[model samples]
Target chain A: MTYCVGIRTNEATIMISDSRTSAGVDNISSYSKMWRYGIPGERQFVICSAGNLATTQAVIAAIERDIKNTAETSLLTVADMHQAAEYIGKVSVAVQEKAGGGAVFEATFLLAGEILGSLSGLYMIYAQGNYIASSRQVPYLQIGEIKYGKPILDRVIQESTTIDRAIVCGLISMDATLKSNLTVGPPIELYILQHGSLTLGRYRSFGEDDEYMRDLRKLWNKAMESAVDAMPRLTLS
Target chain B: MTYCVGIRTNEATIMISDSRTSAGVDNISSYSKMWRYGIPGERQFVICSAGNLATTQAVIAAIERDIKNTAETSLLTVADMHQAAEYIGKVSVAVQEKAGGGAVFEATFLLAGEILGSLSGLYMIYAQGNYIASSRQVPYLQIGEIKYGKPILDRVIQESTTIDRAIVCGLISMDATLKSNLTVGPPIELYILQHGSLTLGRYRSFGEDDEYMRDLRKLWNKAMESAVDAMPRLTLS
Candidate 1:
């Protein structure tokens, strides 16, 4: 299991992913779920994956191999974000089929970034290989253990939200998921791509003992406590 | 679909259930999901149900019939909270079996209350006619569209939490579910049973336009905004 989110605001695109992956309760390992692709200043893509680690790795490997070989439909060859999504979806489906096609080998992804002149966008690719873009109304897409982290996104994310706020919201969302679910753990990866930059804007990783992560958690916990305390008290008879 | 949660605190038991029932997006109606039974002052039970509406209705009807008929193992005759849970589970499985025992006709329940000379407890009864009690460490059980509403419970609920705080948390939890999922909606039914009272302490139903519900939502939204704003900001390059 994993948790990842991709948010496209007016100013930039933000992608966050937790590294923890669990085959079962006892067999847990850390694997980076976010992959960056494309040539700097030409195109940029961040793919955050969930579901079977094997399938995601295979699909990602296929993407890298295609890019290395300049395959006919590789990320470097795709004309737009839509084509990029389609190419990734095709690779994902082919990988799953090669793995014998079942629930165990399924994977999902959130693809976010710009294709040269195209506007920055976010899309969630399904296990079936179909995908849907995040709209101006929602402005975010999440994969894996999504529900625990969704309410905050639904409450705060909008097209007009600032890049810094979106980053904070994404981190808090990931933190909420990590708190409620054991399957999603630390060593979190976050990437930012300023709109039209055609380059990775900022990248940071937070390990379990990282100072910034600790401070963020403390601040968020305090905020939640204050929020809970401020709500109207129930008057029981 | 529905959202129901039962929380047992040191001072009381709190059960909250949304009243929305929908077979499809086009077909929606409201029905009370919380049912109170038992002899007040001697024994009391509150059953908050989710899943197949028909199966829940039948199970509730059967429980009422058994009590009215003075059957051997009715709620009135159950010796303890565990027996009450077993009785309800048995009834639920029987109802599902009568409906042909498939996912379509399955229902789950949260049974919370006290029997004379016993401590208050909360149990989550599954469709398979088995149940598990809420633990001191968790102090809560949720059924149906649970994840969206769970982080708050996981954060604040404790064995020593006061009844009023528990009720407020339960309402906020239900409100979160409502905000995130269309399948679960208002009006909301909340039931409170003070520990050792052996009676329903208070009951309130908030309709779609209820003043208190509106105020709570407003307050919570404001709290969330402030929380989001107060979180440490990211310094992106």
Candidate 2:
């Protein structure tokens, strides 16, 4: 299980992914789920994956292989953000082809970034080589163990949101998920892409001792308790 | 999709269920997922259903039919909470039998209550007629679209928790679910059973305009935003 979120805001785009991957309780391990592509000042894109570890890793590797081979449809060579999303979906489908089918090779990606002179977009790519771009009304997309952390995003995330606030919301959402689900753990990778910059900025990983996350967990618990205490009780006759 | 939760505290047991039932997004209707059985003061149990509405309602109807026939193993005639859980499970299995086995008939129940002189307990009954009682480590159980609302319960609930706090937590949990999911909607039905008392102490349903729930939504959002704002920033360079 995993939890990854990407938000396209008015100012910038924010992406976060938890590192924990677990096939079962005893088989839990940490693996990086965030990938970045393109030259620094030319064209930048971030890909965050969730689902089967082998499948997602294979999908990423296939994309990287395409880039190295100078394929016409590679993440780095794509003309725009939409093309980049298509590249991701194509790669995911290719990976699924290699895995002998039993259960569906479940994998999804949250792709966000910009091309130098083209549009910036946020897309959720499915395993079947299809994608949906985020809209003004739905400014964010999440994949993997999403429900545990979704309320925060549903209430606060908006098209007009700032990048910093979006990042904070993303982190808090992951924190809430981690608290409820042991499958989504720490060492979270986050990527920030400023609108129109064509460059990824502020890429970082939050580990167990990360002060912000510690404060997030503590303060969220306190606030929940306070909110519950403040609610007026119902008196039934 | 549905959402129902049952919490057993030292003071009382809390059960809440949403009134929304849907075959798909288009075919949705209001149906109470909660049902009460047993004599008022002798042995009382509250059951909240989640999953395939038709199957769950069928299970409930079967139980009611058994009670009318003076079956010794019926919920109304069960000796204790464990027996009551078994009775529900048996009914669930009977419902599955009537489905003729295509896809497994999906339904689950959160059974919580007490018998006079016997212990209070909360059990989760599966569609297969197997049940597991909640313990100290896991003092509450949720069925249906549980993930969206689970964080609050994970962070706050305990076996020795007060009924007042449990009730508040239960509502907040349901509120979180309602915010994130369209399938689980108001009005919300809540039941409170005091420990050692075989009768229900409180039962209420909050409609959309219910003043307390409205205020709860406002304050909860405010507190959550404030908590997010108060989290320390990541200062890594």
What overall lDDT, based on C-alpha atoms, would model 1 receive against the true structure?
Answer: 0.89
Highest lDDT model number: 1
Highest TM-score scorer: 1
- Which clashing pairs does model 2 show? none
The top-ranked prediction according to DockQ is 1
Q: Local distance difference test, per candidate?
A: 0.89, 0.84
Segments in model 2 whose C-alpha atoms lie over 4 Å from true places: A100-103, A209-211, B102-104
lDDT (10s digit) by residue, model 2, range A106-167:
79899988888898899999878899999999899999989888888887788987666678
Q: Write the per-residue lDDT of candidate 1 for residues B97-184, one digit (tens) a residue.
A: 9888988999999999899988778999999999999998999999999999998787778899777677778888888899999999
Q: Native contacts retained per candidate?
A: 0.66, 0.67
Instruction: Write down the worst ten-residue block by lDDT for model 1 chain B.
Output: B228-237
Tens digits of per-residue lDDT for model 1 on A1-237? 789999888998999999998978999999999898768889998999999999999999999999999788998998899988988999999999999999999999999878877777799999999999999898999999999999888878899988878888899889889988999998999999888878766899899897877888788776766677777776655
Q: Model 1: residues >4 Å from true position, as ranges?
A: B235-237
Per residue, candidate 2 scores C-alpha lDDT tens digits across B99-162 of: 8743546799999878877888899998788999988898999999999889889888888877
